[model samples]
Target chain A: MKFQQSQEMRNLIAAIFVGIFSYFIIKALTDFDIVPGVSYIYNLRGPLIAPNMITVILFDWRGYDTLGEAFILITAVLTTGILFGRGVLGGDVSEKDSTPIRPSTIVQKVFAAPLVFIIVAFGVVITLGGHITPGGGFQGGSVIATAFFLSVVVYGFKKNVFNLSHNSLETLEGVGALIYLCLGLVGLGLSGYYLYNVGADLYPYLGVGDTATRLFSYPDSTNAGIIPYLNIGIALKVLSGFCTIITVLWGAEKK
Target chain B: MNGSEVQFWSFVTAALLMIIGIYAIIFMDNIIKKIIGVMLIGDGVNLVLITEGFKPGGIVPIISEKLYNQSPGIFQEFADQASYSLPFALVLTNIVIGASTLAVLLGITIKLYQHYNSLSVHEIFKEEKI
Candidate 1:
């Protein structure tokens, strides 16, 4: 009885707080032009270096923050592994209670192989074309992970076509992160600043000769130094990271 | 509605979603429900950030020949007409971070469920000493 009463009180307090917060939020959002008036200066500069503005910001201007974000994902995945990993506390605590269900024959026959191939190809296009288009490493990585997810769902985890073991995924993730770090160090070695793109001469051949009338029309000898490499690194890291997380979670429950 | 008004409406909708999420967190007894509430809140914040980047009459912040032809100095006039891209970038980062965090949380929740054999927060608290 006492607990119930306290719970009600807590609920009331929470409601009051939310109400106050909502009022203030609405007032501030409606009244004040809180939107920053800054023009797309970084974005305008993006084409000079890389084709994508978001990529430039993420991998060049704010490379350190992205590194941190990647690590945060790595740490979170590790924590999840530690918490629920097999053999952590003798064996897997959660076990499969029922037999796995097979999908309809027609559904499986129609859409399994072709869909996976298409999705993977699309993901690759997005990742590689990060410099030229709207999609980037993160988006492409997620799409690839989605393809993996579909395959795992259609064919049982044990019988999936993309038969990448957890160890391989882990290695891929680590290598991706290492490559990113090495690229940053390369920038530091060549230029004084870490992750610096200026004068690194990443795509020397492409930037030579015409130097201006490229298909993308990069500005004034500014090459997309190390940005595409960084995008590839991020794509690998995110793809493997997500794949590992899902695989671990799904396989946690063994028969 | 005007551009600002549209933004205001979007902001209002985002806030309402957040409020609904808060209500779920406070009132729902299911641990999974709480996690869902947290997701809703994150979506609300992402919506607000994306909305903030919207310009009254701006196109996608892409540099093309059309923009350059209009003004050779693409940095000055072309940028003024394009919507801000910074918020979109920030939101993309936030979304990935949120997904990872949510995955971790869900994993923990699964462990808790395995131990307690129940999804109710109250039951788990009552059963466990801690």
Candidate 2:
């Protein structure tokens, strides 16, 4: 009756408003050229000495923003832990009334091993090759987290093959953040700028030659410096942070 | 259609997605549905930001030896043709922030459900009053 009519009226009004709004938005977007005439990426890329412009921008040009983003994730994770109570922080020690679900088939079980291996290997490649390729720490970290998530889903949380405890995950996350902070401090000590890539001088030889060559090489100002280390730190932090969130949420029992 | 025209259509689609997400947030009764709408809005905004950096004729922002070996003057040409990289960087940051926020919100929603025994906002509010 009245409720149904009011809902219909609301829908109509919403439709009209959206239509008008979208039209104006599209018109403005079409008319304006937001793309720059010349991107500063090329000029910055040579000095930063990173093959990937996006990485240089993310880990070098705007490193502080990323540091803040990591803290945001940490705060959110902490909030979730607090809201869920002690079970998550302490691990799933409580007695479960219902049995955990496991993959029931032999075929599913046999293939799971290879799949996990491949996924983890691929994540490593992406994270390590981030400077030379499109993939970066964030993408690689998510992929790694997905691998853990898949294992938990198929094998059940109780019998997860990774055997990652809550404390271990927390420690890994903290260590990652500390490493990032230390790298930034090192840069500040050397170059008088926070998060500067002073270690980038070692990059060119590492890029061109073998591992043996890199060990014998000296640092040059023309290399990518601390960017790779930053990427690794970010990857570790992101992967562990995500894994912690999932593990906490999954372990919490519904009352 | 021309390149700019195609970009314009993309913009239109992104705007529509954002509008639909807003609509869901405003009208949906389910708490989970509102969260889905929030995620949709985030995706729409990310798309808009990424697309805003599109050049009419641009290559990927990566620099190769081939491009560098061409000539010293070629770098300037390459820079002119490359798509803006800043927006891509910004979007990456936005995505991580969005994921964490969504996780927090979902955790809160689960807590609320545990207490109220209902996912409906109206139902929860009614229960609170009594």
Candidate 3:
């Protein structure tokens, strides 16, 4: 058909155009410095501010952006639930996903339990060590959620190691979001800023007492005050949010 | 390869990925392949941002107390030698956003399949009523 031919021609043209444009753009990007950027400034101040540069930018400088990022995951999970007949405008709530999950082999069954524990432990270390090391809450939480995935894949969702109820996962997500909001509110109450790192090392300048600082601060040499807390909060939210999504997609039982 | 060379190759690979993804999205009839195209585009852009963060002979942008205990005055040196952190942060945020969007897209695809009983784009379009 003529229409089909035109569609194919258009697609080819678009692909060629995109390829050429990207090549030029990359050439320009590499050849030109494009003025200066804040990366160097972040590097200079990052050591004194926080040991991990990305953590400082995400938690301290771009806290609002991080909040939006977490909210996106939550929104996606809710949308998935809606698609599965858990919300308004749904006729019947009896549909199940046809993903064809096969029965697990004996070897997989034997190894899955300990593997879940080890994965969860590694995720915790990543979440708690965000201030001084790489792999923050988002990465850590995703890692932890994989353990849930593994368990479900190997043992089926009914008897999986992390067969938490829908209500519990939703509650955990809310708790995580609240932790993040309350921490920002704490900063707002003390200083005029929302996510200001008002822990001991810097709070003295704000004329706050040492006891309050110690209370706000975690035991990190980077003076990374609320970053670790934020990490834990984001990790919890991301973990629960991702798990909720997978559970819904894998087909939840009718309530 | 040097940093610039590495960046060039990375950009080439990213562009190829994006091109293939766009091709899939436009020309492929299967809905699942289209979804994968969306993912491929996101991955290409993420790669570009990551390549932009690369520095020639750069060090990791981390400062630890253990490293400090050995030499308390390595901050300046570390800053000079470290790769760009801003783009790294941006890439991290983008990855999460991309994953969330992918989840939403797949959900929509599932709903569509349930309603239409077919994964072929042309078949669904032909079957659509006014």
Candidate 4:
């Protein structure tokens, strides 16, 4: 009886805490207006391009972290391939049953085309406006990868998204990673730090002040040049890397 | 004490989440549940790091009116202010990493499900060990 009473008391305390938290969260959102745009909305005259700041931070200021993220995806893909690749599929009746018996959904087929087109268009927008706006390589790449995922789920893995087979995706992923490394090496070769402003010396092409004429007194060299290239490389690498995992999982027979 | 209290609550919530995740990993029988626990732990750590970046009574890191005295041609002081862009960026990158890790785990789980009809984590090891 004592144990049951204590358990009930604990549950009551937990419920009270949760209620308090929910109340505060709702109050903050409605009364305090503690929204995501607090940085801008509460205080007028925030940066005109807040999202651009978001993008630059993702790709340039914190490029090393982005590299680490890419490595995580790569590691996951590699691990998946290793433990559950062809070796596991061989000589197993269980594997044969892994393939889905259900046909493709009508709704999926209807939405897949538009979804792929829109995502690809979004990727283009990100790639083009990355320097000036919030979207960048990682964001664009993920968007592109989502298209592949949509196609696979909607039209069956082997039908529409055939270009990115498991073997092909693996190869693309390796190439994507290599491209990122190459861009970083370019920075180190010229600027002493990996992924450093190889773009600074080369910033003028993107309409950033020419490094030759104006240093801009900014502590770091202008990164207008290679930042775009880095963005593209990263976009390709991440896009392929994400797609690779999704493709493999979709294609795999269960056993 | 207002902002400080907020920070304290945030930290406590993060810690509690982490503790729950640790317990889940240790006790959960299913591999998928274990993966979810790991993700919970990652989210808790990320929340702590994000909360650590917030400065009490500090204005947004953006070059806005809050930092400036609004006097004409007096932008010198605000130029040196620290920015919150780094933490925001870290959160985005961490999110991507977390999602990718989850995808891989799901893939593995699918394969595991194929090999064994059940999702119980320990059973696979037990059957394979002998």
Q: Which candidate wins on DockQ?
A: 1
Give a tens-digit lDDT track for model 3, residues A41-158.
7777667667888888888777788988888888888888777777757464746555446888899999999999999999999999987888899989999999998998888777
Q: DockQ of candidate 2? A: 0.52
> TM-scores of the models, in the given order?
0.86, 0.85, 0.89, 0.68
Compose the digit string of candidate 4's lDDT tens values, residues A122-173. Answer: 9967875665556778788888888887777777666764356667787888
CA lDDT for candidate 1:
0.74
User: Any runs in candidate 2 off by more than 4 Å, and if so which?
Assistant: A1-24, A41-48, A86-99, A201-222, B71-74, B127-130
Better of 2 and 3 by lDDT: 3
Deviation from truth (RMSD, Å), model 2: 5.1
Better of 2 and 4 by lDDT: 2
lDDT of each structure?
A: 0.74, 0.74, 0.79, 0.62
Q: What is the DockQ of each candidate?
A: 0.55, 0.52, 0.53, 0.19
DockQ, cand. 1: 0.55
Predict model 2's lDDT versus the native.
0.74
Error of 2 at A100 (Å): 3.5
Model with the higher TM-score, candidate 2 or 4: 2
Best by TM-score: 3
Q: Tens-digit lDDT track for model 1 on A151-231?
A: 878886766768987788889989888888887886675455677653434444533333222322333333566677777
- Candidate 4: regions farther than 4 A off: A1-51, A86-101, A105-107, A201-223, B1-6, B55-83, B125-130
lDDT for each residue of candidate 1 in B1-130, tens digit (9 for 90 to 100): 9888888899888888787788788778899999999999899899889898888887777666655556543466656667787887788888988898899989988788878888888887895543
Each candidate: chain B TM-score = 0.90, 0.90, 0.87, 0.79
